[model samples]
Every structure is written in structure tokens, then in C-alpha cells.
Target chain A: MAFNILIVDDSKTIRSVIKKTLEIAEIPVGELYEAENGQAGLAVLQENWIDIVFADINMPVMTGIEMIEKMNADNLLEKTPVIIVSTEGSQTRVEELIKKGVRAFIRKPISPETLRNVVNEVMGDYDEGGN
Target chain B: MKEETKDIVYKVCCDVFEHLAFMFGEVLDEDDITSVADTFIKASMSFKGEQQSGIVAIVVPEELSVNLAYEILGLEKSEQIDPDGPEDAVKEVLNTICGRLLPAIFGDSPIFDLTPPETTVISYQEWEELVQGHAYISLEIENNPVLITTSL
Candidate 1:
């Protein structure tokens, strides 16, 4: 099944890049939703059949960490897969994200390969490598 | 700028532009940097982390900001600029730079919280206030002037 993914970042350029990168990685995306920040991202979650989320840690209105924390609190979307796609480099921050139930964290300047591998890791046997 | 800070800034600026923006840049001597281009857009953000707390800013020429929006978005070059697109791109590139820069300098054990980058129109005077008194590192992105400053 093709996955429906959501990207949350304040930068339109970054959202566009992530969409482009997903196509380049050959990850079959059923639909792609873009949100400017965590608040908007949470709203997208409510309105779509999103399978995964790729979020930037720093964003206006709401940060990625806050979004994930909210998700964790909501029983409905709590188990949804979340991968942090951010420029955040601090080890301590990474630990905090992991503690909040983030499935993976990928740094900025992310390549097609990194996106593909992380997606595969999250999806388990549903590997894009086979596709 | 301290030699250590300059080195970190230079490396981060180079990496962020080349990889994220698909643009190549090299840090130049402050004397070598010039503000001949008048119209500009500036993006500034603050970072709080284990060892450092400072402001990071990136200023780019007016036209270049629009050009970069397309470049980073993987869109074909166009004559018209999407008003919000250019400013968003400029701000994001700086945010990405700080995000990448922090990990490189502080190691992963420490954490940093970065403010969302803000982009604005500015006169050369405001730009000078930030760039002055430091051996600021400047670059030519696609031959257009770009300045990056970090105050700790």
C-alpha cells in the first residue's frame, strides 16, 4: 500500500524539497500533505489518513517536539510513525525526541538514500528497496 | 569573530548552501566582502544550547532570494517571483545552517533549541550593524553576494 505522508515545516522550500526527495527515493507516496508548523501539522493529522509524519524541530506557531508530544497524548494518533527531519544536531535534543516517541531522526541536507532507508526501517518488511 | 567560531561558521555556511540549496559558497575576508548590492532580505534566528547562545543571520540580495526559492524547491527557473516564496527560502537556509552548525561544534551530547528564523526587508545600515566589527565571512552564491554572521 502506498503511504500517505505529511511534512511539517515553516519553510515552503523545505516541504517542496522533501516531496521531491521522496519521489527520487522511489517511495510510493499515495498523497503528500504539507503543514507550516506543529499546530497545522496536528490539524492535518485529524483530517487525513496520514501514515507517517516528517517534521522539522523548529517551526513558527508550534515546534515539532510539541506536535509529537500531543500525538503521544492522543490515543488515536499516538502510535502513528513520526520521523524528525530537522537541522537539529544536539545529542541531548535527539534523546529528548526519542523519549517523546519519535521513530527516527534524520538531519538536514538529507539525501534520497537517507529518506529511503529511514522509511524502510519504519515500515519494516514493507521495504521500498523491493519496489 | 574568534578563530574557532569563524571556522565553525564557515564550515556550516558552506555545507548548508551546497547541500540544502544546491549552491556553492566560500567564506571570504571581511575586507573582501562588499555591500555594493543595495536591496536585501535578512533572516535572523537565535540558538540556545549546551555551550553557546548567540544570534545567527543570513542576508541575501533581493533577486537571489527569489532565485533560491526555485533552486531549493527544484522548480524550473521563472521570471516571476512568488512574493512569499523567496523570503521563506532565505529564512530556511539560515535555519538549516544553524541546525547543522550546532551539532558539528558542540557534539551530540549537548542539546540546542533554535528560534524559528525570521526574514525581513532591511536597509544597508541595519545590515551593517550586524556585519560590522567582526571579520564577517561573506560568500558569492551563484555570483550574488550573501553574508552570514553569528554573534555569541
Candidate 2:
């Protein structure tokens, strides 16, 4: 089955880059979505069946951490996985994020291989042709 | 800024430019610096931690900003570029640089909160003023001058 993915970042360039990277990595995707901030991300999550979310920590309206907190509070939303794709480098901050229920952490300047690996690790194996 | 800190910032800037933008960068000696451009795109962000709080900024030529956006987006030069693409690209670059830089300077354990990067267009006069007023590092990327400044 194809996975539905949502990307949350304030930078339009970053959102495009992530979308392109996902295509380059050949991840089986269905109904890819984009949001400018965590609030918008939550709105998307509320309206759609997103398999995973890739979000940035620092944003204008709402932060990834805040979004995760809200998700954790919701019984249904907490089940969907979230992976942080940011430039954040502090191990302590990363540990805190993981404890807050983040599924994975991906540093900026992401590569296709890293995206592919993380998706496989989080979503389990899926056929390239969407079998 | 201390010489050691300058060196670290310089190294991190070069690495980020290379990895994030696929652009090669080299530190330019003071004597090697030449003329300033007519305009530049300046991107800046602030970071605060328990032991340290400061701002990191990068200034790039407007022409180079377009190239940066294209390079980062992996777009063909012939394709039409979005008007917001250049500014957004630089902001993201500055954001990533700050994220990597804080840890390099303050160690990985200290948590630093980074503000969302901001960008502005400035004239050559303003660029010269910034260079003269602050201790800034100059880099040569794609044969264009890029400046990095920090205030702690």
C-alpha cells in the first residue's frame, strides 16, 4: 500500500526539497501534503489519513514539539508516526524530542538514502510499485 | 570574536555551503578581499543557550542567491525560478548553519533555541558598513564573495 506523507516546514524551498527527495528515493507515496507550520500540520492530520509526518522543530505559528504534544494528547493522532527533519544537532534536545514521542530525527541536508532508510525503518518494507 | 571561534565558524560555514548547497567555499584573506557588490541578500538568526546567546548572519550577493536557490532545488538553470526561491534558500541555509554551528561551539550537550531565520535586501553601502563594524569572515563561493558575521 502507498503511504500518505505530510511535510511541515516554513521554508517553501525546504518543502520542495523534501518532496523531491521523496520522489528520488522512490518511496511509495499517496496524496503527499504540505503545511507551513505545526498548526497547519495538525489541521492536515485531522482531515487526512497521513501515514507519517516530517516536520521541522522551529516554525512561526506552532513548533513541531507543540504539534507532537497535541498529537500525544489525542488518542488517534498519537498513533501516526512523526519524524523530525531539522538542522537541530544537540543530542540532549534530540533525546527530549524522542521522549516526547517523536519516531525519528533527521538532520538537515538530508540525502535520498537517509530518507529511504528512515521510511523503511518507520513504515516497514513496501514494494516499490505499490503492491 | 576570538580567532579560534572565527576559525570554527569559518569551517562550519564552508562545510554547510558544501553539503547543503553543493557549493565549494574557501576563506579569503583580508588582503585578497576586493570590491563589494551593488546589493546583497542577508540572512540572520539568533540562538540562545544556558551559557551562550548570539546571532549568526550570512550575506550573499543577489546574483549568487539565485544560483544558490537553483543549486539547492536541483533546478535546471534554464527553468524559470520562483521569486521567493532565492530568499527562502538563503534563510534555510542560515538556519542549518546555526543548527550545526551552535553545537560545534558550545558542545552537543547544551541545548540552544534558534529563532526562525530572517532575510533582508541591502545595498553595497550597508554591506561595507557591516563589514567595517563587525568582525566578519569572507568566503569565495562560485567566484562570488559571501560574508558571515556573528554577535555574541
The most accurate candidate by lDDT is 2
Q: lDDT of each prediction vs. the true structure?
A: 0.83, 0.90
- lDDT for B111 in candidate 2 is 92
Off by over 4 Å in 2: A125-131
RMSD of 2: 2.7
TM-score of chain B, candidates 1 onward in order: 0.87, 0.94
Q: What tens digits encode model 2's per-residue C-alpha lDDT throughout B83-116? A: 9999999998899889988888888999988889
Each predicted complex: what DockQ? 0.76, 0.87
Q: What is the TM-score of chain B in candidate 2?
A: 0.94
Q: Tally clashing residue pairs in candidate 2.
A: 0
lDDT of 1 by residue, A1-131 (tens): 79999999888778878998999999999988999999999999998888889999888789999999899999878878899998887778788888888989998877999999999899873344232
Interface RMSD of the candidates, in order: 1.3, 0.6
